[model samples]
Target chain A: MRKTFITAILLVLAAFTARAQTQEPEMADALRANGKIYVVVTVLATIFAGIIIFLVRLDRKMTKIEKNN
Target chain B: MRTWWWKILCILLVGYTVIAGFLIPVPRLDILNETIRNLYFHVPMWFTMIALFTASGIYAIKYLRSGRLQDDIYSAHYAITGIAFSVYGMLTGMEWAKFTWGEAWSNDPKQLGSAMCMLIYFAYLVLRNGLKDEEKRAKISAVYNIFAYALMIPLIFILPRMVDSLHPGNGGNPAFKQYDLDSNMRLVFYPAVTGWMLLGFWMATLRIRLHLYRFKKENSFAFENN
Candidate 1:
């Protein structure tokens, strides 16, 4: 089972890397050079992280309440 | 609905969307060169918002028929989460517009329609706050929710189509998919929509459970006093 799982993972990685090599150049070289693209990525990541943190906090509150009850 | 597998799927799908959306090569067009990639992130926000609001409307209908407080809780949380998604949608759209379109806030028909749709929901929240009685709050808000959602569909989807607009898929402007959604783009786009919808639902469920816990605690407190 472990060997097959590893093989499957390797196959998927190989497929992706092969596709990557054959891929056309991306259109956002200017955005990438200016570092604006990373800005967008950072903003998106931060928002997602903030939301997940909020959910985790809410979950903790509920756990406390359940314990008291 | 609250299965672990689906939540895991949401995480993986969204992770894929973020990675592929930035990295993948898209069909380079004239105006929307790289910003065309915004299709994956910005467009899915609208789809997820609509889906969540639809769920809210269903819960509202259930509340009316069942007269259950739990139903109202579900209805309210879904609407709240939907509103959050709508805000994110509008913000991302404005940011994307700043690049593609001249300004962030063009008085486009779709923009106007989006504003109206959001205002209607804001009115719903304001209406809820104004009422002090719980039973009256649930019943009236349920009716209003159904009415607001009914209006929301036409305001966002139908009305914009009738007029000349800056937004794509309406007016003279060409849609992103008109150039063919490119199987490559579809790979990220479909998963993005599904992932965001699932994430929105997950947040709504968390809020609903939190509200339920508070409601139960209050009930128990009252029982103890009695």
Candidate 2:
């Protein structure tokens, strides 16, 4: 009976450790590893750059209009 | 060239925000997981809106004091830009909430408060359009803008804190600062806010310039006749 109780406690401890290992929060580790994350970063940066260019052009046009007036 | 410096800074900072916001390491937590990055993007929209609205309110006060139609134009354009930012804030918030909070419209206190705040500002626009006379519209709307700004403070910032709210930094929930807004995130977050605020200001200035141009063109005959 003593041996059986010891075995049961050991099994529970092992299960707890296993659960803890698996319980680590999910993140985009796989994407980072494969470097697909950079693709997303590049896409966003390109879009932002495009917007900046548009704003700059508009500002120049406005300046020309103001000068003419 | 000197005047264009801030616009250049705005572009650089926002460009940095886009690149670093994605690549930078962030704290990992359940549920919030990757969506935690939304803090950099989503939260800045509200900050920009608040900044624009504050500018609008100040211009409104200036209009009241000086009775200058130019001040009214500045105030109106600022408010319009502010409303645009608020709409972006609301939509991004809803998208984030749908995935995290399990519903797009959870009727969260902060959400309801901001919605009410938007409606009040929308009424400001409606009030301006309802009148045809320029002076009357400016005077009445200036007063209303002051009232709207006063009400917005309590609705968006104070009321959410007074009640139980799911939003961070409100009610019982700890703000990001207390838990997960680590030093790393702050590096990108602060710049993101500055960049977005500048961008909103730039857009408002563009509208103000356009309006001013039109106003000048319309009144040029008066100046020539004089």
Candidate 3:
């Protein structure tokens, strides 16, 4: 599972870089130049990751309680 | 974990959405510019919110028919989840509006309608908290849930389109079918909607399980005391 996850991440990165090389569409080009878009992406990813991790931990706690019962 | 495939699918689809939404090419249009990409993010919130509330309404009907506590729990959680999505939708929409529409609150018909819909659901939450008796709470809230949802459909969907509004596909603004028909935006749009809806369901399920667990524990404790 870990291996597949790494591979998927790599594939997405590869696809991203490939697209970057092609004709870029009309976007916030200046924003992309300074790599600030990554800031937005990182913030979004972190928020979601935090939420998912919290939910998973809650699920685990519930499971332990159920087991005890 | 029992039905994990769809959960995994949700993660993948949303991950794709975040990445492609920023980097992917979008059709260039006047006024919207790069903000057009908000379509993938903003629009899906409304779709997911509607989907969740629909489920809430269905469960409300089931609770009324079966008189089952679990059904009421499910109905309540779904409404809560729907409210979460709607709140997020409104905030994001306001942000998008500030950039495009020149004001945060433009008195748009769609905006007013959605605000009223959100308040109705908020009232549902308050109603639930006011009742102390479980059975009474369940029955009354179920009736309110059904009624609120009936009003919600027209408020968000129908009433917005009937009047002049800054929102797209309403009044004189071009609809998605006209503007987005030729773009590849639909590729990500559909998946984004599905992914967000699934995520909302996932959250609701977790809440439902947590509620059920607490109820069971309380029952067992009461049994021990007896």
Candidate that scores best on TM-score: 2
Stretches off by above 4 angstroms in model 3 are: A1-26, A32-39
**Against the hidden true structure, what lDDT does model 2 obtain?**
0.94
lDDT of 1 by residue, B36-78 (tens): 8889888988998899899999999999999989899999999
Tens digits of lDDT, candidate 2, B1-226: 2289899889888888999998999988888999999998899999999999999999999999999999999999999999999999999999999988899999999999999999999999999999999999999999999999999999999999999988899999899999999999999999999999999999999999999888888789779889
The digit string of per-residue lDDT tens for model 3 on B2-54 reads: 45688788888887888777876677666787998888889899999999999
Runs in model 1 with CA error above 4 Å? Answer: A1-26, A30-68
For model 2, name the residue pairs that clash. Answer: none
Per-candidate clashes come to 0, 0, 0
Please give the CA lDDT of all the candidate structures. 0.85, 0.94, 0.87
- TM match of model 2 to true structure: 0.92
- Ranked candidates (lDDT, high to low): 2, 3, 1
lDDT of 3 at B187: 77
Q: Which candidate is the best by DockQ?
A: 2
Show where candidate 2 strays beyond 4 Å.
Answer: A1-22
- Better candidate number, 1 or 2, judged by DockQ: 2
